[model samples]
Target: MSAAPHIPVLLRPLLTACAPVRGTWVDGTFGAGGYARGLIEAGAAKVIGIDRDPLAHRMAEEWLPGFHGTIVLREGTFSELDRIAADAGAEQVAGVVLDLGISSMQIDIAERGFSFQKDAPLDMRMSQSGESARDIVNGADEGTLADILYLYGEERASRRIARAIVAARPVDTTLALAEIVARCLPRQKPGEKHPATRTFQALRIAVNDEYGELAQGLEAAERALAPGGLLAVVSFHSVEDRMVKRFLQLRAGRMGQGSRYAPLAEAEAPAFEAVTKKAIEPDAEELASNPRARSAKLRVARRTAAPAGRVSEQEIGMPILNTSRTTGGGRPRR
Candidate 1:
């Protein structure tokens, strides 16, 4: 038999919201089949699993038989959840769970190029095929790199990091990039994390177009979920968490409807209810076991019985800055 699926963080809360009883559920990330296994254990009739990573797809094929529920694994991004769910004959899915972040398996595998601590090719694409992080690092201009770090990684020293990266061109491996970033910043005296951690995060986010996928995925989930269905998203960083938080808030009719006093036509309520007023973080036990869980925040919302509504492509309303390169002055990394 295949190895056990990694234990998902916040599994109890996710299962509580999802309540996977005898109905179809979607495990959008399917990272190491953790949440999917839980759904099966909770007595789901069938589980439709989707992942962008080919490695994850292979894992699902190998390990899904261990679960009780019928499993269907698809090699695709969650952004296409509607199509995938429909194609699987899973219209109006009872639940959809998205665990947003790199899987532990991916980080453990050095060839995937996700962990900064490892020495491997600078590739961070979630899909098996895509432009790698090495391409972006070597090709992007200082401005473009800085914007990526700032917007995605929320790094305040984006400009400094960008300048350092551009100066040290053709950073081919994880360690090379990490070392450059570490050198640019002051050495951590003790009990401090690597300075390149944020830089690696920014690069991975850019390489995978994570936020973009998430925006589309949220819309797809809204469309695919059945009335009263649950939509739970676990985000590991601010960028992903912000997207989930805003998406749910917008769906719950909190995104300032146009012109309250202009005699607007009576419109139906949106097709979702906020399950949790605020995002939920992992508990002490989960954090103790997996330090990665410390950064994870889970937000769940239930689909309303109303007809589905059109969601704007620009759900977040923040300007998605163009990722093109620019010729700009460099700053020293501090």
Candidate 2:
């Protein structure tokens, strides 16, 4: 199937924040190559486009060659973006751009199982390998399912929905699971989102280990970027946005002490400076062109000269769950 055309969310603001975008840059989540193309067109000497999904590479084959080696397409996760950049002959990149969440291509494809709007096999693996949503739905215990729904999707009726899922075991299709979840919630009103939306989001996040990857990817960007390098991330949901916001704040030395009663501890040298103190959202024109950009937010920061360091998962509010049984799923081992 031909890939759907994608409008890269927050592209305008991202380019503006990282202006004079010379030198090598890494498009960490290079879905549809939108950000990579934008970077190259906006003055980046080279763009290393990295994506875990094989479909992304396949789609790029048709158009990436036209760039004449300005854009190097690599099939890999952004969690190891530093390694990917170094292997591509760039030890330190000038910028890193990550668009968090599923790409339009994946969501629009019914067989990929990212959307509940279509009935297809329950597969949500971005890499097209490892445990799929079907495995988690059929194998995970009620408690694990509930935790995933609650922590990842922020669904208030996680337990109830999980119970319904358990009762309908061997659910192997996207619409089947969507129906089960919807049965547990109220009917959707005219403007309200579908009842199954949160459940589908939770399953997809678990199947792809998206939260874990996001945390590791941020650190990888920190290590890969040269001093004064830019890190621009566009997140589609609150959980993802909060994690990015907090990570940037902590790295920029904007984190506050516990309370007035507690003594202020010595702060480390800031590793980054905020390019945008607040998250940038799509303007009215962009929103009108693409309603999917409604929930998207862009946060940009510039790297300082300080050495790269580790960040605690708790500080970034990463969702924690026991994913030991699921192959290739869970937080990166420190």
Candidate 3:
């Protein structure tokens, strides 16, 4: 509503990769409706925009009306996108676009507590209702916290950071928890990301169950698309990009063999044909204009007539925490 502060990363590359973007499309992470609006303007007859965040729907009230009925906003996660599309009279959409990870809009707002830069409450719930960072930071066992940081954020100093976090009990604010994390590692240098970056990213991912949602959502997109329909995903980190890349590559039968868990199963036809043999990155112009686009990578594929198939969590390289992830203040056993 406030003029789309978030820029749709890799828009030009994504659009160019998905040229002739006609028919109904699904913008799964419809942060500020930038991708939805872009699709509609590029040629989509209608776009069923879906986002788990209620804030997105509320913020869209002012601008969505202007698009008339071309843009329909839905309050739900992309994991249920197939059902949402079916219910919206789009049983098989022409395309699906998912921008993975936290939205810039969420990080920009001080109260969201997504950014380590701001001194806000440690609340980083994407849906605005759930166990927040404060709950995890002040509660989760040291081992659990370590696993989360290591697996989710790929932080090497996860154990040390987790130890510090558990020692500094009752960390209430973003900056407070950040300070504790920063102390566990070397100080930040000029041009280097803050020491708390990985820790914060890990907590956000765990709190939101992003990797799990991503796996399910990818399968859901596979189910929701018609033959020849396009699927475009833009990821900001190595782990997420790896998951997307592996999912598409495996589904396209380019993984050289079937998933280890399903190696004995009958040969299934490739469900998708890779459109972009390699991931598309943002141009220098876009990166210069929006520094946030620096890490963005886009991958596009076209659905085939093959039945929607399953890909094991292991096949896509999704990081799985062996320990329990339930929210609590339980102390870690030695």
TM-score of each: 0.90, 0.96, 0.94
Tens digit per residue, CA lDDT, model 3, 1-334: 2223888899988889999889999999999999999999899999999998888998999899899899999988898999999999999999999999998789888888888776889988898887888888877788888888899889999999889888888888889988998888887789999888998899888778788888999999999999999999999999999999999988988877646786755668999999998988888899898999999999999999999999988889988775456473221211
Cand. 1 TM to true fold: 0.90
Which candidate number maximizes TM-score? 2
Q: Name the runs in model 3 displaced over 4 angstroms.
A: 1-4, 258-265, 323-325, 328-334
List of clashing residue pairs for candidate 1: none
Please report, as a residue range, the 10-residue window in candidate 2 with the lowest summed lDDT: 325-334
Q: Pairs clashing in candidate 3?
A: none
Which pairs of residues collide in candidate 2?
Answer: none
What's the true lDDT of residue 262 in model 3? 64
lDDT of 2 by residue, 1-334 (tens): 5557898988998999889889999999999999999999999999999999999988889998899999998989999999999999999999999999999999998999999887999999999998899988988888888888999999999999989998999899998998998889988789999898988899889888899899999999999999999999999999999999999999988987567888777778899999998999999999998899999999999999999988878889998877664432454445
List residue ranges in candidate 1 displaced over 4 A: 1-5, 66-69, 258-268, 313-319, 324-334
lDDT of 1: 0.79
RMSD of each: 4.8, 1.6, 3.4
lDDT string for model 1 (1-334, tens) is: 2233376989887777656455888999987887877887798888899988878877666667766448888888898998899999988898899998788888888888888766889988888676888888888788888897787677788899889999989789999999888877888779787888888887787777676677788989989999888899998877677678777777787776567667655656877888888888888888887776887888989999877666553666432646434221111111
TM match of model 3 to true structure: 0.94
